[model samples]
Target chain A: MRFAGRVAVSLYLLVVSLGLAVGQRSLEVCSGCEFTSLHAAVQQAAPGDRILVRGGVYREGRLLVDKPLSLLGENWPVLDGGGEVEILTITADDVQVRGFVFQNSGVSHIEDLAALKADNVSGCVVEGNRFSNNFFAIYLAGSEHCSVRNNEVTGAATSEAFSGNAIHLWNSSSIRVEGNHLSGHRDGIYLEFVQDSSVTDNISEDHLRYGLHFMFSSGNEFRRNTFQRSGAGVAVMYSKETVMVNNRFADNWGSAAYGLLLKEINDSTVADNTFFRNTVAIYSDGSNRIEVTGNEFLRNGHAVRLLATSMSMHFTHNTFTGNTFDVTTTTSRSYNDFAENYWDNYRGFDLDRDNIGDVPYRPVRLFSMTVENYPQTMILLRSPLEQFLDYAERLLPVFTPRAIEDDRPVIGKP
Target chain B: MNEAVKVMKYGFFDLLRSRWIFVYTVFFLLITGGLLTFGGDPNQAVLSALNLVLLVIPLVSLMLGLSYYYYTRDFVELILTQPVSRPAVFLGHYAGIALPLALSFLIGTGLPFAVYRAGNETDAPVVFSLLLAGLLVNLVFSALAFWIGLANEERVRALVIALGVWLGLTMVYDGLLMGFIVLMQSYPIERSLIALSLLNPIDLSRIVVLLQLDIAALLGYTGAVFQRFIGTAWGVAMSLSSLVVWIVLPLLLALRTFRRKDF
Candidate 1:
């Protein structure tokens, strides 16, 4: 009786597998095939069906997939939008788009015209796609559990007035934007009202505006990303509980540029990042309770420009070398805390061999204070007089911010 | 012109062989080379060289010009006894001393950079600007030294004056300028600060180079004012002309004294 029951269960499982195999079909869409157009192929394709698109230009105006399907491009099939319409729009969950070149989407002011867009979709995967000169490259609106991986998005945007973001996420959560190379957009990756996303291993360069701009986005973690030569660099505003780690911000130098601008950001942690040659490595305004630790700041203008409005901010275990000013502040009273950070300008000694300087190091120079008050006094930069003033100010706490000293400054690279 | 060139040639040959010039050149080479090897970035190497150049080059050129003028007084007198005009003798001796000093600075700081292939197209301009600033500093300070030499009869007094001028320009003048600016902080002193900073050649050269090195730092409010003034083509032209004037005025004054002074 037991052997008979086991045989019946095995037969039932086999029958169910056969039914699924019969239901799910693989369709080929090529120039010589019956379904030449991707729009028709996606229409005919049922849920859980896989459509293989061959190497050919599919000038389908708009290919909207309303059902769950997998579209795999064999030889990087071109989905040319002809500069008049959106290329691929996914409306259903569990849709996967892989190995396609989406190009020349229509430019619009009222609507975002993306090469590939997902609306209210979940568990969608956009992988190994190349996007060129689209108004918006890969856009996700109200999407959850979506992943945009290993995509290359390049635009020739000149001005911010007409350009859109390369990868834009709106009201999306649990999204992963990883291993993407983006350039020449207004912003490389833009997150507005997004939450619980992870942006990792992305190289964003030469954008007209911010490289990674997110506002009202919370609990998003960014790691191992590089942002360079953008107009305003990376800006995190009106956000809380954001964590950025192992990222590099480089060469973002201009009148309005900053390596990282934390505006009204709270309870965030910035760790193990590198900032090089930026105008201002980190500019904090009205930020509170942020921990910046284990970072490297090299050759920047102002390593950290902390405003008086920032409260309870901690800077620790960071190495700052070759920067013009290690720290500059707007007020003489500092509410921020800087401890155990290695500053190259620190002149104190470590007689105890504890690797911490016995004498507290002051990062705010007198000249910086003077320049703060008198903006025209920047002409006196690197002057011996200013150097002397700063040296003297170090000896005596006169005009510099006394509260801005690092009590236990590190001796060498941390 | 012929007499001046001849005099310059004699002075140039004499100073070029001196140990001071060799040491100056070697000093630059070692610093620049060391920075390139260990500093990692060529532009950063140039930046380190800039501080040393700004501080040392002016003092070296000033002292070198003054002492050369003082020690070579007998030779200059002998030259003056020739058919050469006083202005020619003065100008030629000035060129002779200035050229060698400038050459030493160029070879010292420039050789290591060339070997390293230091800067790309973007960084090349910065390096070039730094070198230019050093050259201008050399010219301006030496001219001030020559004027002091002609004005003071006693070598000791001339040396003291030369040292004083160097100190004032390099250190004290900016202090005074700061004091002035602070006193007038309530007023709109961007234009005035520009005018006042132009008065000191060291401050002027420092500002010009600072504009290039710390432009990002300078793009803030006051820095923006300077960027507008010295960072623009017009501002650069203005500062360049001002530097030229700083070089010319001292020499012209010395020229007048050289023509009229007794042996």
Candidate 2:
């Protein structure tokens, strides 16, 4: 019995010693340590170790991350690009880089180098970094399951010809973009051939061009985002199965500015979005099988403009209050359905008190028709004669698009 | 005539007597001259100089004008007790300030032009335009200071009102115009740009100078739209008219208010 007890004690001590050895394998890289530079520490670190880069200006070259390690930048260490190529390049999976400043990237129309570039990598996290004065801030291509959050990207865009996008994603899937502030670029975020992405809680403002642009991408969701004072708030083209919800589009006012522009999009849902003070709320061209419901259009120049090629878009349960023109359609036979929308200018009565209009509410004003023809007849808007003519058209329902009528108009503002 | 000459003379002497004015003038000349000499492109240099002058000249002029008005408030009161008309006294004081400021700006900006003329002849006209811009800015600020002085009795209130007017003219007016544009997006009020230009003094000034440069194309469709609606000559006339009104109307209102007030 004594010999058996001694053998158990020896085995327990050996196991405890092995556990401590495994715990000490993950090294710490502090600022005041022997390894001064981040690159140096990264080079010395093995896989699954932590490289803690403390705060200072690391005037370093492009840092290539080839190991599956955690590289954390404490206190926002600045990594100047030195007017060259990318600042950080990731080639490994499960890498995490946080809290760094990337600046002064070189301009090349052909190369398209970003401050942070990740290619063919997966399960990476990039958060809390400042990207300024660069051509492109973050560029992820052919990557999967990566998360980018809480980053600020600002560019001093002189002209459209020489500017680059703040964030560019190409052929990436299952990516998450959250809580970023992007401004002053050609486009705040650009996605091409990307799929199954989620972009939420982001503010993209004052861009030289579109705030958010995605082309040939599908199965994406954009929620709780704010696009303000941009040339165009958002543009989705040649994509399908997308959802845009609870976004605010404001102050995007120019001759060609729009809150949202959809081209060749099919089977998308744009609901619960608020568009205020944009030149046009939604400009749809060649888009079909889309549902626009429970949205608010306030103080927009034109709430909805459907071109000749657009078809089969359903508009229901939306509020059109204080819009200059509720709807504008080019074709004679509009295939779209407008049902159960509250039009502030609707004059039809519901005698049964069911809140549904007895007569169908024709939302397309005669002024919009005239503007479509003349384009400068917009100067006559708000004039006393124009108001009189609008009232007459509402009473008569002539010269407006016949199919573009809201069947059930709600009495109260939605 | 003698009394008018005497007032002008005293105004000149009053500005020259302040040691801070000399230091500021010398510093302005040195800094502007250094920047122009070290600048890379002549066009960029002129633009930078114009921007600096637009931002700094008005501020300096306002400070100088306020100090002069406050220091001479008692003298102005005593002068009001005398036989001279208030408008004439005001005009004489303005002429005194304007002459010295124009001289300083020309001299400070001219030396660089003379040096740059060895390689570039067009620098002369550009420098001249920038100097004129500086003078106009000074006039606007000085007139504003005079109006503030006449409008308010307390020195602190007068200074605060002057600063507030300056901030409104430069910074807050653009923000308010943008807000107005956003609120009225549905209305086809592009024609309202004409009336809007008439309200802001800085926009009027920008239109005048930008039209003179004939680079209105750089401002894109908005500039072309503005040019088509209001011709170059009409824009300049409107700007001059606005400047005259900015000077005269404020003084008139202040004069009436001063006459009716207890002070």
Candidate 3:
């Protein structure tokens, strides 16, 4: 009797495994389908089911995915907004939407409506979708473990006031935004009150405002992205424990444009980035506990501008070349630590052959210091005699920011 | 003088007659007005509008110049058969196309500013300078288009080459400059600034105008350097000289090339 029971149990297990393998069904929803709408098909879809939408202009209202289902579009299917509301709304777990074009979202300054809205969802994937002329492209609010990748968001941002972001995340955590092209929006990507999110390998250009703007967001890692010809490259504010690495911030030239602006941030790591030809490479205000390393600052208007309140940041292993100003500080009492940086303006000797300077290199210039004291001193920056004065001042540091010195300066470019 | 005025008048009327040009002008006006009304700060709004106008006007001017030259290849041929010099014809056609377009640009760009009253009083000079700079840009591109049209007998080839030149100037030149700077970082060759600044027309314009804004501090370290070298009256003189060089040298080269060509 025991042998018979064991054999029966084995047979039951085999049957269950087979059922699990073949139980997942695929539902085909075409333009000529009886349901005729993506929302209708989604409402009818069961757990572990697939809804394949064929090529057609589907004037679907906001598609609320409230079930564990896959909604796939074939041949570049378009979801028209019909001038009413958002295109897709995801409120369920384990949802996937791919390969569709979402367009024509209603403009609203009060509400942050997006072409694709992912809210309170976990393990969701949104990929290979094209969003054009939308108020906001992809918005994640209070969502977790979500991935938005390989999407194109193009906006006709006439003004910063009327237009919204291409991709915006608020109060969301553990989100990944990767491999996307975002252009011509107020901001290409914006993060607010978010934590533990990562944005990587995205190209954001031609925006009216910042290419990437993050406020009160912490524990986020931004890497391998390119911000070109935007109003500003990126703005990180009021956050802690973040990492920015290996990004190219270039050609973002304007009156107030900066490659990166760090404001009130603490305990962040910024490394291995290239800031090329921007108005300002890095502008820091009241930021602290940050480690900046292995970055190249090239041909920017100002490489680094540290404000009075900035404190406790470690800047090392960075190369500052061809910038208008290598370093500028408003006050002499900054707690920031500068060491092991390769300043193009460094004129100290390296007699020891250890790639370290024999004497401490003061990154601040006397002219810059004068500007700090009296703003009008900048009027003499390019005068023929000013060069002699600068050389004299560099030979013997005077009136420069007191605390603005780089110890252990590198002989070679970092 | 009368003939030149007549030529200008005819060119204006001819542009007005083209449906595509009218349509494009209308489209530009609508878009520029809409953007200025809705976008962020008044300064940024004006800047953005100017940027669009600068980018689009050149392309339009290039295309119009190219097509005008192509369609009126016979007219040019007839004028050449007469007692008129090729240079006069070239200059006449250039001034004719440029003046009207400049006026239209002023109208299209200026009308929005009047309607919105968005920008500050300080912004007026920059705005005016921006418009004038854009007109210069139009002239530069139109001359380039004319040169291309003259150099290449085939209309398609001329159009293609003109577009290529535009792309090279606007995008590829910057990319190359970045690459060069990265490659040559070790040397104290910051002296190359003078030569490099002269090569690109856009940089010349930016340096000259940006210096006038007196916001050099906002521009990273390079702005300080620029302020040092080129921030004063002498710097402005240098910038103006470079601009003149950019304008005249290219035209001279084009003229020589055109005169020598078998076509």
Candidate 4:
């Protein structure tokens, strides 16, 4: 009697396993279909179901998902918020939101609103979406193991009083944000308390404030990002162990603007970056132990302005060309190490043909020091008298700090 | 007066024969035209062209001064010994040299930029400012050259002195001014720098044109002092008058020296 009971239990287990394999369902949500909106589709969906929302202007104001499902849209189905609230809100884990258009999140003074808001959920995916004229297009709050990819976020904010960030990440870990085109926002992408995340292949431009503003974020990486023409300035502040690679910073010109601003950040490696046409390319303050290598600074007002507090920076194999001033510092320049850089202002020759200039290249112009002290004396720039003074300063250095010399300035562009 | 015009007409034709006029005209044509054709935007073209104007205008003006005085010594001596009086000969010669230089500059820049402009309104003002600034610099330098040439006895000495003044004003004066600022970094230098810029015609012309080109706006500094420097009508009037002074003062000094000096 015991042997017969075991055989029956084994047969029951086999039947249940077969049912689980064939239980995955794909439900359609269209204007004419049974499940008309994403809300109705989510209500009927079980775990691991795929909800396909078809193309149309869906005035579905706010949607909530409680179960694990893939919410896919075909042909960018419009999710209009009606200027009142967020269009989509995800509350469950393992959720996917893709190929949708988000527009018109209401201006809020109290709450931090977003078009696609993900809260406290893990393994959420937001990708291939277009965002326009919205406040905080992709807001990831306390979410982990998520990815936001290939999204177009654009808006012109008249003022910072009511504007919001394009991608605002808060208290999130292991998020991957890549291939996004962002412009005209208060900030293109902002991160606070985010760790172990990577942002790559983003083109951010024309912001009233900053291209990328990160604060208190640690252990993050930025690669292949282009930031251009941001007005207020771009800053990386209070961060640790960050890596910035192959990024381009261009054309941020203002009295207070800089291409890349580093404040109180430590243990970072900024490599293969290009900075062009900024009033000040890199303004670093209180940042220590940063390795800046293989970068190009071209046609800027001041290539690098190292404020008084920075220390222990290593700049190697960088090219400085056509900048008004290569390196300007308020205090003496012993805080950093420079090596093997190429400067257009370098008037040295190599006798032995080693491709290394025989004389050390001095990068600081005395006029830059004057400008730093006065800021109003910039009218003397490019004057023949200033050029002569710069020539004289190189021979017998007086006003320029002595420690800002590149001993191994290469003869040719690196 | 008719005799003055006759001398002026003859002097104009004589200057037209010289190679300097063609080269001057061609240089302006190529630079302005090249910038317009390739420099992406009209504002950028103007900015690039300003550097050329500041450097080239003074150098060429000095060269023309030395050549006009030394190479044409025989002609001037012949005209002076004729029925022509001092004013007609001297003033007619001055007009002959100045008018051609100014006209060539105008045609060289004007033709190219007009061809490339496509009737854009904003571009016209920028080009106009550049043309006006070039003319101002040219006239000032030409006048200075005339004075230097008139003061010295030896032709070689006068030529050397004129070139020296060009170098000193363009290079050494600026150097000394820069060194002074560096040495006195503690004191206020803004008002002084503005005052110092007024002392050099090239510097003054540069600032006037650069202000019109909106370089301050390009650099994103909308400061009150910068705006007040060239923003108000009073500021405009002041700079224009200063430019006129640069033109008139040197010419008057040349006339005084020429009237008394023996050939």
The DockQ leader among the candidates is 1
Give DockQ for candidates 1 onward, in order: 0.50, 0.02, 0.05, 0.26
Error of 2 at A350 (Å): 2.0
lDDT for each candidate structure: 0.88, 0.76, 0.77, 0.82
Pitting candidate 3 against candidate 4, the one with the higher TM-score is: 4
Query: What's model 2's lDDT at A154?
Result: 95
> What's the CA error at residue A34 for candidate 1, in Å?
1.3
Q: Please give, for residues A1-414, the per-residue lDDT of candidate 1 as tens digits.
A: 999999999999998798587788888999998798888888888898999999999897998999999999999899999988999999999999999999999888889989999999999999999999998999999999999999999998998878889999999999999999999999999999999999999999999999999999999999999999998888989999999999999989877789999999999999999999898999999999999999999989889999889999999999999898899899989889999999888888999999999999999988888878876666677777777788788778788878998999999775
TM-score (0 to 1) of chain B for each candidate: 0.94, 0.85, 0.85, 0.91
Please identify model 2 stretches exceeding 4 Å from their true place. Answer: A1-31, B1-263
TM-score of each: 0.91, 0.62, 0.62, 0.79
* Model 4: CA > 4 A from native: A1-23, B1-10, B19-52, B59-95, B102-135, B143-200, B208-224, B227-263
Put down candidate 1 lDDT per residue, B187-207, tens digits, no spaces: 877778888877887777766
Identify the CAPRI category of the predicted complex in candidate 1: medium
Better of 1 and 4 by TM-score: 1
The TM-score obtained by chain A of candidate 1 when compared with the true chain A: 0.95
Which residue runs of candidate 1 sit more than 4 Å off their true CA positions?
A1-20, B17-48, B85-87, B111-126, B152-157, B183-188, B220-225, B228-238, B256-263
Per-residue alpha-carbon lDDT of candidate 2 for residues A1-414, written as tens digits (9 for 90 to 100): 999999999989888787566652445445577677778877887777777777777767888999888877777778898988688889999888887889988788888888888889999999888899998889999999999999999999878888889889999999999999999999988999989999999999999999999999999999999998987667889999999999998878765678999999999999999998777789999999999999999867778989989999999999987566789877778999999999877787989999888888888888678657544334334333345567788777778878888888898664
Tell me the tens digit of each residue's lDDT in model 2 across B1-263: 56656777887777777686677678767866677676544544565565556556667777778778778777767777898876566667666665566567667766666666568765566566666666676677777777777776788888887778767766566546545555675765556755775676555555555443322321222334554554456656776688667667766775666556553
Q: Give the winner by lDDT.
A: 1
